[model samples]
Target: MFRQATRLLVRPISRTGSRRFSTDLPVAETADESFVEAWKKVIPNIEPPKTPLSFMQPRPATPSSIPSKLTVNFVLPYASELSKKEVDMIIIPATTGQMGVLPGHVATIAELKPGVISVHEGNEVTKYFISSGFAFIHANSIADVIAIEAVPLDQIDSSSVQKGLAEFTQKVSSASTDLEKAEAQIGMDVHSALNSALTG
Candidate 1:
């Protein structure tokens, strides 16, 4: 029993497992210098691989004074819609509910669902329908939004959205398997959001 416990304790730590931590919040320590130094001593020819957190640029710290405008950076896979554009406010459809972000908002990372993101600039408001993605609100009046797929409000086809909603509604009822039902439900949810974005 003593020998088995010693073996378990002496086992090598997995580099893959060590890199699996969430990147939503800021990490105080980017790299373990002691571990790297040990690795260098063991294998002098090869350097240790850097993790994703190491490559990420450090964000600005929270400001003491609240700014008047909120800077937004909205990007998709293929295009960047808004890049450091200052806006009055942004209303995001978060899983918890509709979240309104203003200047100097507390730092938060939100998993976004299928819904309309309303970007308000004084009297003018621009809207976009996001399929799914995340929103990272920084403490220094900066909001970074990235989505899998995002379409402008006016660019979406309302008639096709209504048709898809009807199709998915029927699919949800007729689905035979659990996986099928879940997929159908997801389809229905997206269509529902699109329909609401158009009408609402």
Candidate 2:
């Protein structure tokens, strides 16, 4: 049988003298020293939360730096007092309803229905009528409003609008499919409603 024993030697030592302890067998002190060294190195790299209770700090959100000015292109004969440089807010007819877009707005794409398009340019407001089209605005404080058919208020004729309404009503009544019927009905109803509302 193997037995391990420890020995102790005592002597009168001075107050500043070093005391030593010895073991019967070899023991590793390097492991403890290495572990402590490793922990010290890892502590600085670990991140601490900004808050007192949190474990990690949150990253800051990226800022959107948008430029000034807006460019609008309309396929129809629409005119506006707003210049490409002075536009701030845009009010246009969307498939759902009227959409009001302002500066620093989030990016979006929308389908425009037939209705009056009002754009807010600084202190002035401009209005135009648009047919089926799409518009795109960016978070960068700029918008490129292009449409398929655009008609200025002064350029829009009552006779042509009335004719479109009558034809649309007929199409809506006899539409073969749900999709066709809905589209025709929406267009007709929107145009009719706009004529009444804007002309009033």
Winner by TM-score: 1
Each model's TM-score, in the order given?
A: 0.75, 0.51
TM-score of 2: 0.51
lDDT of 2 by residue, 126-196 (tens): 77776667777754565566666665676777777788889899999999999999989887986796576
The worst-scoring run of ten residues by lDDT in candidate 1 lies at: 21-30
Query: Model 2: residues >4 Å from true position, as ranges?
Result: 1-83, 174-190
lDDT of each: 0.84, 0.60
Residue 173: error of model 2 in Å?
3.4
Task: Give lDDT tens digits, candidate 1, residues 147-178.
Answer: 99998899998899999999999999999999
**Model 1, residue pairs in steric clash:** none
**Pairs clashing within candidate 2:** 66-140, 76-150, 78-152
